[model samples]
Target: MDVNALPAGPASPGHVLEVLRRGGPMTRQELQARVGLSRATMVERLDALGRLKLLRTVGHQASSGGRRAELLAADEVGRCAVVADIGVSHVTVAVADLTATVHATRRLSTRQDPDVVLQQVLSLGRELLAETGRANDFCAVAVGVPGQVDPTSGANTAPPTMPGWSGTWVHDTLAAQLDVPVLVENDANALAFGEHLADGAPSTTLLGVKVATGIGSGVVFGRRPYRGVTGSAGEIGHVKLASHQERCSCGRTGCLAAAASGRALIRRLRSSGARTLLDVVRQVEQGRPEAVALVTEAGHLLGGVLATVVSIINPQQVRLGGPIGALPEFVAAARAAVLDAAHPVALRGLREIAPARLGDSAALVGLAGLTADAVFAPAAVNALL
Candidate 1:
């Protein structure tokens, strides 16, 4: 976790990859400056990385003092990863390289059995790798589950929907099955990391709000996902939002998720004679008063919870993801509630509230980044070379 600990020897390939990851293709001088290494050290590192096929000189840059220096970049296709997002209803898999380009993706309906789902994930990953023609290129696998995760042990401690997943050694089980290193993380946290890396957010502190089958949030500070002491820092769903007394999946009453989650919305809609979320959207678009009222109510409830989030984190911007967050009517309602309820100081200098750019694939993209980190960790890359 210490960013300052640069690996030893000339074969510190990950340093070069890390430099290219953060700054894109850089000249040798730029690499030396960014990596804080001497010219000889930088050259050795680049050479070793190139030899390992992790980094390569892709082009040349203009120079004033001499011939243009070769520009170094990651050889993305040479070192790949498999990423999965295990949601309540489905599991999405993606194959990505070191630079995080998703080469192939697949999604499968999920079952209540965790063992069945794990097998499906492995099968889907293999299919994706075969499609990419890089079945052996992968170095690691990363999975995001909608639950509390112990990062060190990679165990799913408590998941609301996944009954038998709790206390399961997910990383170890998957690693043993796939014969690769694996990392398991909370789904929301994974989405937050994905958004932070892809959205070009300005603040080191980021809050990602996911409003799908369930409501949840993720916080990333100092360039790392922040899971609090008990790995429940951003379980905003469990926070009380209503006094009307409705039970949550966690056996708690008045939980925000019970009031505003997609499942809640769907339940309400079904009760009111609407069949699906698409039906609600269609009715809203056609100016149905009841549909508009339902979405707006959900949004208002969500915003009331987010007002507290904004008050505590004071993030530069809040990125909303999942089906509910992308709805225009829902977004407008939530924005209105936040502006009306949250403190002025928290809103000061706040940037725009927007839907996630990656859409439904955000968690998978995040898992790809995590896989890259696990595979190309300074020590791992050194061992590979």
Candidate 2:
């Protein structure tokens, strides 16, 4: 398929593609009716997309009264997007298509060096594309970093824990290496997108709290991510705690992350040889009293911070996420604290307080969905193709 041959500056093709991606296979008549394009214009757009290998005729729909209509769908095999979710201690890489279907995923221990981590992610993405026989067919790359990302520059401007990521040009570097557009977002915000879309999150207002090696929060309002002015709106980890004394990786003291993060809990339990958050979680899972108490305390601290956020955002749902969120004790304590601190009016709006449904793959899936949306949009696709 020659991407350059595809028509540019037309809205119909992208609308058709998006319709097929979201609603699955649809008949030509259905697509025409939905897009409100004339029959000839719809046919022309479909044919153009087909020529570019972006759309395919999957099968024929059952005849309603006369002839069977051809069912068209997004062609998954034609193109793919690479998604990376970079955590403080882990990284997840995947290959996905415009339909938001993930093809393959690989997880690896994260490295402190940004170069090393990026190389691993790119290598894994390339391998997945090669394995799927879609080499050079990848359109764009999206990444989720565990820090405050400047949306315009794709730089980690205020990374609280990821010291190595400071001043790093994530999007530019990825674009230069992959020869494609790159989108960078905060990991928590990505997870919020994933959780909102994947789990059928009911509310127009949603909050995702990530209590991992570091702490962070993501807010989705009206089905859109609420990224504040500098894209640092949800850096809840840096919120100060009265009793916190531990020095944070961002060279601050008394921050929420310093006192209540998984890293902080692990540090307190270091004498037990707990080097990673997983070790601490394992201990909690085994019903270790010491580990349970520490995590539960962290949860209370996190909830105290979240209560203020709840009052401000008035989100209908608060989703617990990351490794620390998996523990029932931690969630219970956090819930209790939130109930105690949240304003009465805010509590009325709040509904569910549950664990994240998508688990570790949330950020990867969110990034893939975002990349597809940006790259496959009408104007963007036309310009690229």
Candidate 3:
């Protein structure tokens, strides 16, 4: 396990891949400087990677003197990753390259039966791969479900909505179906990872809040998802709201999700005579007092819950994602409430409260990153082999 004793030169293709994975494309000189390898050693690694079709010489850059240096980039077509987001109402599948570019995507309505849903996922994944003409290049698959996952076993532990999914061997099941290693993650955490990878957030501490059919938060500290003991660290949606009597999908009363999620907002809007979220948005745009009031209230409730999260985690940035989080009015109101409720210290270092840059595909991109990590990281790949 000694770092220095590990294979060097062209033999350390994995290490070179890891460097490219983190730092993007670089010249041999730059790679050597960054990865602490000699020039000859770096060239050897690059040549091996090129031979495997994992890296390609994209272009060249002018050097201080002498010949131009060849710039190398990942050969995305040589390897692909799949990500599946299993939500309450739907399942979304996406295929991406090692650089995290989504090439193809598909979605299907979710079923009550976990096994049926998983089978549908496999079918859709194959369809996407065929559509992208990347069936043979696919290296790994990652799934994000709405629940706590045992990282070691890849088993769902206690997802409130996905009743029969608990105790399911997700990794083994999907791996068997796809003939590739699979990694399962919590949906919220996956979204956070996607945001981190896509947006390139400067802060090492990031909080991603997803306001969909349910409200959940994901925390990334020190560039890694902070899954707490039992892998339920970011279940902020289940936090009890102040003295409310609304019942959550978990059969608990007064959870934040029951009070302020997109479902809750939709329910309130429907009760107030609005037909859909679009209708509510139109009404608010038209200055309909009732619609504006309702959305503002939901935003306030969400921000109130976020206040507690900010106080505890004190993340440098808070990114809103999912249905409600993507709405401009909702974001405005939430930002106002967060500013009013969060502690001064937490607010002092706060960079910005904004919508997720990746929008609806955040979870899918995160799944791709997870898949790449499982396939390319030295330790994870070694375990797989």
- CA lDDT of every candidate: 0.76, 0.80, 0.77
- Candidate 1, superposed: residue stretches over 4 Å from native: 1-17, 33-38, 63-66, 201-204, 273-288, 383-385
Q: How many backbone collisions does model 2 have?
A: 0
lDDT of 2 by residue, 1-385 (tens): 3445545443457767877776769998888887778887777787777767778788999866988878888776566788988887888889987556678898988755787888888998899999977777798888888877776666776365565666556776777886788888898998888887775643568888888888888988776678887788788999888877779887889999888888898899999879998999999999988998999998888888888999998988888889997578888988999999999899998987788878877777778777767876777646544
**lDDT, candidate 3, residue 346?**
93
Clashing pairs in 2: none
Stronger candidate by TM-score (2 vs 3): 2
Model 2 ranges with Cα > 4 A deviation = 1-12, 19-25, 58-64, 76-78, 133-137, 158-160, 201-203
TM-score for every candidate vs. truth?
0.89, 0.89, 0.87
Considering lDDT, where higher is better, how would the candidates rank from best to worst?
2, 3, 1
Error in Å for residue 48 of model 1: 2.6
Error in Å for residue 26 of model 2: 3.5
Model 3, position 25, has a per-residue lDDT of: 73
lDDT of 1 by residue, 1-385 (tens): 2223446654355756666766778887887887787787676777677667777678888767877878877766577788888877778888987666788888887765788888888888888889889887877788888778865555676557767777756776787877777788888898888887786653557788788788778888776788887777788888886464777888888888887877777777886676655566677788778778878888888888888888888877677887777678888888888888888998884575677778887777777776776676667776665
User: What would the C-alpha RMSD of candidate 2 be, to one decimal place?
Assistant: 3.1
